[model samples]
Target: MDLASEEDKEITIGAFNGWDESYAAAYNTKYALEQDGFTVAVESFDAGPAFTAVSQGDIDFIMDGWLPVTHEDYIQQFGDDMEAQGCWYIDAKNTIAVNEDSPAQSMADLADMADEYGSTIYGIEAGAGLTRMMQDNMIPTYGLEDWDFKISSTPAMLAQLASSTDAGENIVVTLWRPHWAYDAFPVRDLEDPEGAMGAGEVVYNFSYAGFTEDHPQVSQLLKNLVISDEDLASMENIMFSDDHYGGEDPDGAVAEWVEENDSFVSDWKAGALAG
Candidate 1:
């Protein structure tokens, strides 16, 4: 039985993308939820497929719902059919990461470095909110019609980023904060001249309709959950380092960290148990 069905049942939780940090974090949360008397089965899918699954009630929830803007279109399409469980992180921002070797320190710099950058701006998942925002807004706002913006899946885009960054070549790609990539890479967000990408973001936990009634306890846990930037940064730091703080698995390390930091964990989970 899925966590949602068990008397102390295991719930099937899933992520939007396989490579996202949320996959590891979900396992950490799963461990804590189990310790609190629940079971969890975690899984992952690319953005489009994940939305379809969640909308069709195939998955319980996704913790990486970047919102009220970035994933706005997805939510609009799926909102009536899904329940937004809670907000997890606030004041998030999307970034434009460029190779450290590039002389481009800002969006304007990219204009001059276009030749060096191969006249391209790489982005993740063509239909993704960020990519669409860049295509429909940022490019036009900044007059980047001449530049080719490449759209590939998250892993492919990041893999290319890693390769380009490693080679100290000039490359620009969509990036975001409160994500491991920000910590792992020596990159900077290109300065935006038009501000079309916006400046703030928040992470939300979302589920399909009727989920609250089906899994009241888990819903309560999710509704009561909130984490600060500092807490998230610390968690991200630990999971990204050594390939293993609790072993080779980032999820295991996060689980151990949460267990050890009872006080902090309590702030996010224990509250649900209280009221």
Candidate 2:
């Protein structure tokens, strides 16, 4: 448990591509571990590959696994090979959102106003659980079979959102809570009367099976971690800003956040390392 120990000094964290919360969690943990004299590496991959890497012990852990819903299949497949560190954020949900001024107030309304939205519903990566839900449930449940469900990266969807909003045009996109987009864009989630998107979920950290045994102190640190929505949103607002987007200086953003919230950082570290 010695902070200066040479053993278990290095760690690797896996993240989903273009997920802002994933980056926020990974980089925040990296900074914290570094403060304890541990070296950490943050790597990005699609959800499926990221889960595979962590389960097979190719990486140490991941800080962003939405559970009991969004990633139920991944956990059912890989849970035996990994340990749930804990839930760090809660009440998370996948959503289909539109600008505040849009006339559609619910999912049911989308079908009738499909033409106004250009008959398209922008979405993130095809492999994302949100994408699966939309394809298998939301679309069919809401009678949107004839509408176009555009599949692309998260950044692409965000770009489309930005463009549409700027032009004062109605647009619909699949999104989620605890996301920076909610703050960055003038959007609101459409009410899902059918509840096809599922209920609120918890975001958890999962490490390789033997990670806790190999690094008990670090494991304890992770177990003690919890981030509030406001704090997480604030950090992400900075991390995903124009200056820090596209893998530019995210570490610096974390550093700035840490500096601004020294007491919170100190309390978290002390609670974990305390006997």
Candidate 3:
């Protein structure tokens, strides 16, 4: 029975909290692995640490790499040891959004209308890649020299959006796709013609080299899990609903999402088996 190198029956999935898309994918996949009899260990970290952990094989894999821009530097640094997998969610991206009623329709318009938005651009965590990109690229490229890019956590930023939106005030913040806020509020992304933030992002499942060869079944399932914004948002809505989590405990939201999307989950599992 011990003829070969001991195979790890347990797989650890690394993720970062506050980022809804990342959290959703990793949490849901953890449940899926459990269904396949794999003891799933979950770990949480900031984006940078998560990248390094996966690179050193300290963490098995991550399901929320926003590629082609966000996480590019991290991949360049540690990606030699990483196997970037499928683009599970293609519309993943970051943007500056204002109330749907705001007059500024694009990044170009933000500079002139900064006063209208209270001369402030509320942003997520200071360490976020999106924040870096906005600070380093978007503001300068858009001629928003007079505006303030306020650094705050995602939850805080969302709260700001809530208060601003409730009073029908014009407010802009750094937001991304695959978030529950789209359903919870009326906001739209400001068009970026200069491509300061690069093209729309695609969230990828990243594993260490030889992951497929070592764990073929689970690898295939993660690779085959292609979901749209609506599907993911629906999952977030249920899993993160106050009635579910904040009202009590986590309440097995991912499993509930899987059960609701039994057809999709079944197809992915079948593909893995066949692969």
Candidate 4:
């Protein structure tokens, strides 16, 4: 009889970097997989590339698919080639946040007073699903053609938010819920009356076909995974904190978080095995 291949004990996980919760979840899941005597390889890419990687069988799966709005097209595109293991987080919000004191309280307001924000809307990675929706749907739907959409990385946008908010100046940027930025800065999400940027979505664990049958235990654990907004934000904040990991070594940070929440981690793994 042939011995089991070493590849059977290994799993590759793809993740996107611009979003903190994506990294946090990917790292957390990686740790859990390691505990089960499996080697997990995590590769980071922009949202578009990440989806392409999974669909093309370049990576086993990714844990950051926001659905019903943000990544709906991706799901339609990939079709039966990929499948969702489970939904772990709900109402995954996309936002246009501004300083709490800013005059603009809604997307409509932003269209009128673009000068207050320097005629530019700070944005995250251009390949992000959120960025795409904003460009293709929101901008045209809301008549926001005048505002310059500054497509950049998340950190750069956060830096601009920090600089402007610190000086009591107004700034608006594309942001998301369950992110550390909500805790680190005094900002509020703008109202989108037109629902152009999509509505509340759920974050999902998506994998290539037959991933579950090949790696049942690991797949089950991910499918049984459930996380709340408070706990998620706390974990993400730890990963983002300078005093925690200093923005480096996400695995170390995840290990620390796992240790602190031993009961939660224990329950997660045990529940998976039991079910």
TM-scores for candidates 1 onward, in order: 0.66, 0.78, 0.78, 0.73
- TM-score of model 2 relative to the true fold? 0.78
lDDT by residue (1-275, candidate 3, tens digit) is 12123266788988876666677777777776666566887787898999888888888899888778778998899889999767688787777888999999999998778679988999999888889998899999998878888998987998899889999999989988878777677888889999997678788899988887887767777877887766787777676755445312232777777777777666665654223
In every candidate, how many clashes are there? 5, 0, 0, 0
The whole-model lDDT of each prediction reads 0.72, 0.86, 0.79, 0.82
User: Positional deviation of 77 in candidate 3, in angstroms?
Assistant: 4.4
Candidate closest to the true structure, highest lDDT: 2
RMSD, every candidate, angstroms: 5.6, 4.0, 4.8, 5.2
Which segments of candidate 2 are over 4 A away from where they belong? 1-7, 45-58, 69-78, 111-120, 125-129, 145-153, 241-243, 260-263, 270-275
Deviation (Å) of 236 in candidate 2 = 3.5
Select the stronger candidate by TM-score from 1 and 3: 3
Q: Lowest lDDT 10-mer window, candidate 4?
A: 1-10
For residues 1-275, what per-residue lDDT tens digits would candidate 4 score against the true structure? 01122248777888886678888889898887777667888899988888888988889999999888778888888857887888888858877899999999789887788778888889999898789988998788878898889999987998999899999998989988878777677888899998977778889999988887776767777877888766687788788865467568988888888888887677786664223
Candidate 3 clash total?
0
lDDT of 2 by residue, 1-275 (tens): 34455477889999898778899989998998898788899998999999999999999999999878778999999999999997888869989999999999999998889778988999999999899999999999999999999999888998999999989999999998888777677899999999999898899999999888888878877887888766787688779866345457889989988888777667776664222
lDDT of 4 at 221: 79
Give stretches of model 4 more than 4 Å off. 1-8, 46-58, 69-74, 100-105, 108-153, 168-170, 241-247, 270-275
Error of 4 at 263 (Å): 3.4
- Model 3 root-mean-square deviation: 4.8
